[model samples]
Target: MSILVYINSNGNKIAKNSFEAVTYAKKLGDVTVVTNGKADNTILADLGKYGASKVLVDRSFDGTDEQQITRMVATAAEKVGAETVVFSDDLVGKAVAPRLSVKMNAGLISSATGVPQGDGTVPVNVFSGKAFAFVKANTSKKIISLLPNSIPVEEVGGSASIEEFNGNAGDTRVRVKGINRPEGDIPLPEAELVVSAGRGLKGPENWGMIEDLAKALGAATACSRPVADADWRPHHEHVGQTGVAIRPNLYIAIGISGAIQHLAGVNGSKTIVVINTDKEAPFFKAADYGVVGDAFEVVPKLVEAVKKFKASN
Candidate 1:
């Protein structure tokens, strides 16, 4: 079987999730990596360390125009003779995978987590990451979109041989006029720890405490849906059913009432901490640790304690 994985390079390096996708691609057969635009050949070569045998480049896919990418991927897949195509189920993959699947008549498994079982069966979460489903594509072509943080990236030592697969990519109707990046070193969803606030923070101005705590703990900062929608926080920092979902190692909620939609997103965290003045807030029910207190006063103390702990160590 010839398997190919799409590589979303982060600068000269491949995105972390792409590494996980490459890890999965390595299992099926000779793995080939497809990248867009010009990237450091050294970065493409490093993919060999993750089990890729070939690398294909298509410069046109670098633009955010979805059609350009769809055409490029479609053309690249055919050129590589790939039976299976792997992608990280992040923003870019979500935009491109379905179109590629339709163009190739390939079976698609979006948000797939585990490795394929016998007979091309892979597992995916259903009902908004609430249920399980097993899927098997009977067709010869298969498309697998892997969830970030779903699998560990495997490392091997050896440079992958670079190869060029040529095609005249099509034009995209939609174009990216510009790009807006989020501020901060820690990516919230991918952070190991997260500190969030809700209506109880009173308003966005109070976010300073949450930000301080997050910085101290090397954690990400987020807000409840209402707070974000209210423009108290950036939409990117919102976490809930209708917003971003995360499964950080530790989730700290300050002043959140923990409605079902809100909890659904954070329940996957390994540990949950709730801080609210109201003991009866629904968030307490799901919290591993609860502190019934004012966030303003309690947050400062918590920050001091975490800072002290760091200093002590």
Candidate 2:
């Protein structure tokens, strides 16, 4: 079987999600990587290390208009005679996979956690990570969007040759301007660990300890829905059913009562740690590790412990 995997780059570097997707696709069969925009020599070498047999760079993508880009990728998959195509279940994958499915008349599965089974079925999370649903496509060709961090990134012995493909970009309706990123802030979707707080900290003035602990752990800082709604934190930092959904390796909740909506967003986390003064807080029910204590007393010691560990190591 031949598989075509889409690799999304962050400037000249490959995103972790795309790497995970590539690593997952390598297990299936022969893998071909298709990248949009410009890819540096360093990134191409990294793809070869991850087992990409051939890398097709599409410079005509122009990084705008998902519709036009989807057409380009679909055409490339056809040219390569790919039986299956894979993508990282991120913003770009979410936008392009369904379109490709329509264009190729193939089966499309999003947020898939595993590779195809013997019956061509894939497992995906249902009901906000509450359960698993098996999905299958009746079509001969299939498209899959793998969830980030669901599969470990393993290196296989292989090398890839780079090839350039100038695709039909079509009429560009959007214009590129500039990107604005805040300094020292990690994108929650890509963070391996996240430390989040709620109103239990009292007010926004008391968020220093949370930030300090997150900084010490090299984790992203998140907030509950109420915290963002009340303007204590930005909306981007909010995690819940109504906010951002995250699937980090470790999730630490400070002073936040576990509402079902909040749990829905982070239930995909590999491990959950909840710290709250209220012993009756609902969050403890879902926590892998629960500590009944005040944030003021607990966070400082946790930060100190992290600092001490780092210093010793």
Candidate 3:
């Protein structure tokens, strides 16, 4: 009765959220990882740092159809005698877990935010992370999807032992469509600190200062939903109820008036700092710290302060 984690093959390295899943899995059983690409041992080495003891390498781990991959993992799960299969609550994980649970006739718990006890009960939050509840599995096999950013990763040890899966990858129906990414070195959804703007930025051409602040702090850049709707920023950069929900350690909202929908998405951040000229803006109530001043005037000075702070440190 061990916990088995399915690590995603994102680019050459592993997915950041998968690391959190590994951390959660290690607590329940022997940590095992599955990789689908021809990544070298170095890629697996990082996983080892976070306590993954073994990595199962599969040539067919590609973005094949759900039917084939579910079978492949299910076969491996049965062979390994994994009583419980854990997956990160990601796009791919959300898609595959239910199917895998149904195919294996296992109990399914999606969006689990905490570790499960030896018992069948799993804890989850509801009402937009406002409340907690325990979910119990009905079957012998329990499959759980863990939410991202719920658990922090700690490097206990183990680079990972690489093994091969005896499955063919050609049977999947889904094919790779296309991949798109941000312009900078960091992906915002995964960043610890995020420097974001809203429609208050006026135009996209004025984004240089925003980028400068983000670059200085090694943070990701983001914008409000309206900015994305206005085409001032990419839809990918939009953060709100209809957009991405971020849980960064620090989030700076420059010129954003802070709507209820926007607050719903960003309320998960550890610390929120809002900068706007309107003193009575709704965002101020939700902000951990706020500055009631124009962004154009305040942003440059704030950027300088951050630079000085970093330099002094």
Candidate No. with top lDDT: 2
How far does residue 119 in candidate 1 sit from its true spot (Å)?
5.2
What are the per-residue Cα lDDT tens digits for candidate 2 across 32-130? 988777778567867877878898877866474678778777877887899999998887888889988998999988889998789878999889999
Model 3 over residues 34-84: C-alpha lDDT tens digits?
657667767876787887777777775566366666777787686678888
Residue 186 displacement (Å), model 1: 2.5
- Arrange candidates, best TM-score first: 2, 3, 1
The lDDT for every candidate, in the order shown, is 0.83, 0.87, 0.81
True lDDT of residue 193, candidate 3: 91
Give me the overall lDDT of model 1. 0.83
Better of 1 and 2 by lDDT: 2
Q: After the best TM-score superposition of candidate 1, give how far the Cα of residue 129 lies from its true spot, in angstroms.
A: 1.7
C-alpha TM-score for every candidate: 0.89, 0.95, 0.91
Candidate 2 residue pairs in clash (backbone atoms < 3 Å): none
lDDT: worst 10-residue window of model 3: 166-175
- lDDT at 216, model 2: 99
